[model samples]
Target: MKVGITGASGYVGQFIVRHFLQRGYTVRVLLRNVQKTKIFCAPDGRFEWTCGDMSNDVVLSEFVDGVHAVVHGAYDHLPGRYRGGEGDNLTGFLESNLNRSLALMQLAHGAGVEKFVFISSRAVYASGHLRGNLQEHSAAQPDTFYGAYKAAVEAMVSAWAYQLHWHAVSLRLTGVYGVVNPLARSKWYDIARAVVRGEEYSQGRNATEVHGDDVARAVELLLHEADARGQAVNCSDRLVSNREIAEIIQSISGERGPLPPQAKAVSPAVMDCAYLQRKGFRFGGVGRLRQSLRELVEAVQKEQRSSQ
Candidate 1:
């Protein structure tokens, strides 16, 4: 099977690409600048890449051609567009991501792709206090433009699949953390460094998170399951608090510093992946988060030693 992935150079996209490649699937990556992704492109013949902006019709057409599935992970966020939670550059962000998303959906449908997987967000769920349980069928009451845009595209994709007979799966993901390379962003590292330096760390709001590899695994499963068609499955694993994360970082890094105070009792927003579990998908996000953080500390130590 051939899978075409947008945003293949991004943090999440890289994991998805590696996942499919490891599974022995022919992967086609669409990027804005292929030259910038040299590290991601393996010499292995199974990977094909094209460089073009998503707004171009010719690019979209060429990308979808002969691909059995499409994974949409393209999102554009402008600097200072979002402050607090609401966005200020609503129009620019929407035009860049949402419009292109609709266009991609239309193009993928037209090109006879067997399956389309959209990387949606858990923020699509009602966002106020983060107290309620979120399920696959939960009502969408987005609090931010980012969430609103994702929710809108999810609806559009589902409607398109239902009316046009296209197989679609929208995986609503939460915070994703993993470190495959130096470019990988893992918040655990930041906290560990801060603790090691005895610096004051910010105690921010907490949310459910999943590992990036686990998210890619979910995508792999959805691509092959016929029952996943037109389904929006929650991809989050477990709710983790900021204090817990800080403690874990401190323990793993063996650093004793002014860690942030324990977070107050807020209603933890736990996302239900029961629908995905019912389909025989076992989640390893929360279970492996600690191990991943430990590995990250080890990687940092190794990098420091190599540099020295």
Candidate 2:
């Protein structure tokens, strides 16, 4: 099988690429800068690359050509933030992120791709207090432009999958954690870095998160599983607070420092992944999380030492 993917250099995309390569598939990635290919490719698998982004039609047309599946993960957003990713270029953001993505979808369909996976976010659900588990069927009430765009794309994926007779799924992900490499930081990088330095930092909040590897697994499941076609599945592990992460950081670093205090955050809702659970998909829970964070801490230590 050949899988074509955008955002191959991204945190989660890196994991998806690695996982797909490990599964004995020829992976083709679309990238504006091809220099990052070294970060992803291994000796055991065949990896191909395209020098373009979502905005380029000719590139996109050729990118999706002759692939079994498409995984779209690229997003043009402000650095380190999604809600206000548009910054001052609202029109540009819409053009690149939303409009061009729709173009990619159509191209994939035209080329007879067997499956498509759109990486949607949990931000599609309305912000504020959630009364119950965030089900996949929950009505999308996006509060940010980022969430709104994701919700819109998901709706299009579902509708198109139905009409085109293809296996398509939108994996609604929460905060994706775990590392691509020791130098490649995932979620919670800063907190872990701060703990490695034994410095005082404040990020007293919690969020629903999942390992990047598991997110990749969800993508793998949705591609071939008949039950996943045209479905929106939630992919979340559990709610992890900053304080708990700090304890793990200290434990791994053996720095023995005071932890961050528990502060109020607009968090607490956990996405219900009943469909994934039913599929016997096991997430790497806290154990894997700890291992990843420990690597992050050690990476920070290495950087610190190199600088000194």
Candidate closest to the true structure, highest lDDT: 2
Residues 169-226, candidate 1, lDDT per residue (tens digit)? 8999888777755432555666655665567788765667888889899999898888
- Measured on C-alpha atoms, candidate 1 has an lDDT of 0.80
Cα miss at 247, model 2 (Å)? 0.3
Residue 252 lDDT (model 1)? 79
The local distance difference test score of model 2 is 0.86
Highest TM-score scorer: 2
Candidate 2 clashing pairs, residues 3+ apart or interchain: none
Tens digit of per-residue lDDT, candidate 2, span 1-308:
99998989887889999998988889999988878888875544478888988877899989998899999999999887878899998889889898988999999988898889999999899877675698888799998889999999999988987887778889999998886654635677778778878787676887788988899989988888997888989999988898999998898889877788896766678889989999898998989889888878887788889989
Query: What are the models' TM-scores?
Result: 0.91, 0.96
Full-model lDDT for every candidate: 0.80, 0.86
Lowest summed lDDT window (length 10), candidate 1: 78-87
**After TM-score superposition, what is the CA distance of residue 217 in candidate 2 from its true location, in Å?**
0.7
